[model samples]
Target: MDIATGAGLLAGLTVVVTIILMGGDLKAFYDTHALIVIGGGCLASTLIRFPFVAIVHGLPLGLKFAFTMRSTTSRDLVDELARLAEVARKQGPVGLEKVDTDDAFLAKGIRYVADGYDMDFIRDNLERDRDNFLMHLDEGQKIYRAIGDCAPAFGMIGTLIGMVQMFSNMSDPSKLGPFMAVALLATLYGALVANLFCLPIADKLHVKLADEETNRTLIIDGILMIRDSKSPTLVREMLLAYLPEKHRHEEGEPVPA
Candidate 1:
């Protein structure tokens, strides 16, 4: 699980709820008309911008990525590649078939090498797979961003409608409170929905997209190095370049225990 995503979401919701409860009755904040305005507008706007498939598939995919952690880290991939390099040197490409990896992209590359595929073919397929995966992440990011963008505009619309209604009722003191409630409530709903949910998830997905691209690229390089029959130490050093500077080890360092 992604602790940061989960923790951040939970903390935001907790603070919101606590503030609401401390202020007054939470039920007073609820208005069916306000909800319909914000919810309906966001949904309609999103549909206008994206296909239904994006809502059906993209939303769940985005949520899944937000809540889950990547199975393999770049450092782990370097270590795994180094080990596989030794196997390739001693037992040849066939030895790679016995290896296991947590990363699906790395596994696919390993399969290609073990099957005696050409290096160009391996690189092309890996790059295609990486691009396709990144494209989906991009779609998810855009969908949520659209929703976040639409919400506030719709809230303002609803508030304006409420104000118009409130003004029309100026002669009658009785109906002002209800109309004003709709106005205030719509804004509240929009702010909460955009800030607490859609926008944050969109930003998180953007971060995920970048990390995935980096990791997949790193895996591709490591896989090709293994295919070339590079020495284990050399592969280790080369793959270490893909990691952040702080994570890279120095030359002639003691071997990991």
Candidate 2:
């Protein structure tokens, strides 16, 4: 589990709840009409913007990725690739068939090499896979972003509706509070949902995408090197370039000619 995503969400919610409780009469903040206008309107707008299937399938999957701990790190990927390079160097590309890995991308690349595929074939297929995966991630991000964008607009719509109702019902002072509550609560809900949940989830998904891309790229390069029968040391050096300078120094020596 990703502690940062989980903890940040918990902290934000705790603060919000604390503030609401401090204000007394927390039930006063509950406005069902406001919720319907803002929540329903946001969902309707999102549905219009994206494919129904994408929203239905991608959103939950995106959230799961954001909250889940990624098992593979760049360093772990480099190490695994370096080991594969050694195996290929000693026993040739056919040796890779015995290698088992949980990483699908790595496994696919190894399979291609073990099957005697050329570099062009490997690069083309792997790049296409990378692009498709990234495209899906991008769609997921867009979904959350659309919700963030629509929530505020819907909230304002609710506020306007409430204000209009308040003016029309001015003859009765007792009904004014409900209308005003709808107006204010709608805006509050919109801000909270957009900032605390939608946008944050979108941002986290972006981070996850970046990390995945980096790891995939590293694997691609390593696979190419392995296919070429490059020395494991050289493969290590090449992959080290993907890391930060501090990490690179710790993980590898200078690349030799």
Query: Which residue pairs show collisions in model 2?
Result: none
> For model 2, how does the per-residue alpha-carbon lDDT over 74-172 read when each residue is reduced to its tens digit?
888888899999999889888999999989888999999999999999999999999888878878888998898889888899999999999999999
Name the runs in model 2 displaced over 4 angstroms.
Answer: 251-257
Off by over 4 Å in 1: 171-174, 250-257
Where does candidate 2 have its weakest 10-residue lDDT segment? 248-257
Error of model 1, residue 195, in angstroms: 1.4
133: Cα error in model 1, Å:
0.4
Worst window of 10 by summed lDDT in candidate 1 = 248-257
The best candidate by lDDT is 2
lDDT of 2 at 222: 95
> How do the residues 90-202 of candidate 1 rate in per-residue lDDT, one tens digit apiece?
99999999998877788899999999999999999999999988887888888988888888889998899899999999999999988999999998889888888889999
Q: How far is candidate 1 from the true structure (C-alpha RMSD, Å)?
A: 3.0
